[model samples]
Target: MKYLEGIAEFCAVADVGNFTGAANKLDTSVAQISRKVASLEKQLGVKLLQRTTRSVSLTEAGTQYFQQVLPALKVLEDAQLAVSALQASPQGLIKLTAPVAFGEAFIAPLLNTFMQKYSGISVQCTFSNEKLDIVEQGLDLAIRIGKLEDSTLVAKKLATRHLFVCGSRDYFKEQGQPRSIEELKEHSLLVGSQPYWRLFIDNKIQSIPVQGRVRYNSGNALCSAAVAGLGIAQLPGFYVRKALASGQLIELFPEYKDKQEAIWAVFPSNRNVAPKIRLLVDFLAQHLVSDS
Candidate 1:
């Protein structure tokens, strides 16, 4: 017996509540539908339907199996649709939203390359610090940084944005480097949205709270301040990689460094996910992972 055919029959009968009604819906004979259901039950070694002359109903076991199999069948159908969409030409506008800084630094460049490769696909990318509802705003994809709090969106890891605690050479000379997380208190710190910064020390992760003379919402601004010898700032790797390499800013407390902060591509869970969105997500993962 064909597994999918059996599943189709089982679902049909479960939905229409009788072999005759199911047959009508499936555009097949009642005898054919009944045979399919019988074959399915034989294959699974489980009684899936209880029938009488006047009425048809599921057994206790059948009800429980139907509850599980129905959703599983739907997912299998969706997977088939997704594969079919992949074979079709990816011609669509992918509405995407991303963080203001990361979009500018990383995603924008990749989009340039991606667009060049897939000429048929066009992307309308928006950069904002404000989080928008992807479904509500009709967005196809979103690039998210850091650990996520919301479980509604399906997220795929793209890359890691490691945070670095650093200050310029001149500032480090004058104010001195932090020997430990505790020593950060002695210096003027440049901070961002969160009061606490993530750090890893000797195989342990810790969140250290630090006060700063100045705080900026923009990570770019905080990095600029640290470069100008304002104060030490805890910033992401992408923002400070060049400066750190140039010795404009020196990494502080090397003993307590997290490998890299996580970055993810998020999309709303729905039926018939667009090929354009799927293409972009997979492209991003490959592009970023290859570069890393």
Candidate 2:
């Protein structure tokens, strides 16, 4: 590290052509800069600078060495400056993952606004329902909905995900509405990923087995099918909020509304969270917690 430290001083003296000039540029004493250059030359077993009372110039070997090492030193300095800039302000690409439906409906738009606010920052999002390893996948953060499993990752709750049983007005008009959990079997069902509907009944959690004509792996797709009057579907509020508001879908068993799980911004359990990731999480929490 000592030898490495002198490289910068040598480069500075070579560039400025004098120890005093290099010292002023680096905010150090001329004697310190001179000693650093001398140490660097002694370590290299070759004189790197020719010094006089009036001026300083590089030896032939110094010129060749400077040409070779200056570019690499410049690269290192640039990297340090980039990191310092990030510490001062949020910037860089945030590699993120989220559930497809939520990502498209909410996170994508939220991130769009965040990027507009901080032009130095950009985001790459992977929308999938699959649970990915945040560390192994090298993702900066993940937006997760539903009960989080026990893990080593750090999670910040953004909001509560409320599950709703919903069906199109047309579907209910044709098949009639379910008055209770037991009556769900009598109606056509649209199931996503899970084959059973989980609900809170009689002050206890119940999982009712449901068979549907259309089964999908995506909540968005199931919500679409339900809106088309295919069947009743269990979906998160974010998926059906607009449909319910537009009178295209009706919420079923409103008294049975269950807090299914929570939405979370999850990241690796690192000692220090990156500023970009922390700021993004806070931004999301600010917008989503109220709506949830």
Q: Could you say which candidate leads in lDDT?
A: 2
lDDT of 2 by residue, 190-248 (tens): 98898888788888777888997899987778989999999999888878888989999
**Tens-digit per-residue lDDT, 1-292, candidate 1:** 3666678778768866777767754556889988988988898889988989987899888899888888887787788767768665667577789999878878899999999988888888899988876654557678888778779778888877567889999997887777777788889988899898889966878788878789999988998999999999988887888899998999887667776667888876543466677788888888774212
**What lDDT score is found at residue 227 in candidate 2?**
93
Residue ranges of candidate 1 with Cα displaced over 4 Å: 1-88, 289-292
Evaluate residue 237 in candidate 1 and report its C-alpha lDDT on the 0 to 100 scale: 80
Best by TM-score: 1
True-structure RMSD, every candidate: 11.0, 14.7
Kindly report which residue stretches of model 2 are placed more than 4 angstroms away from their true locations once superposed: 2-88, 289-292
Task: Return the TM-score for each candidate structure.
Answer: 0.69, 0.68
- lDDT of each candidate versus the true structure: 0.80, 0.82
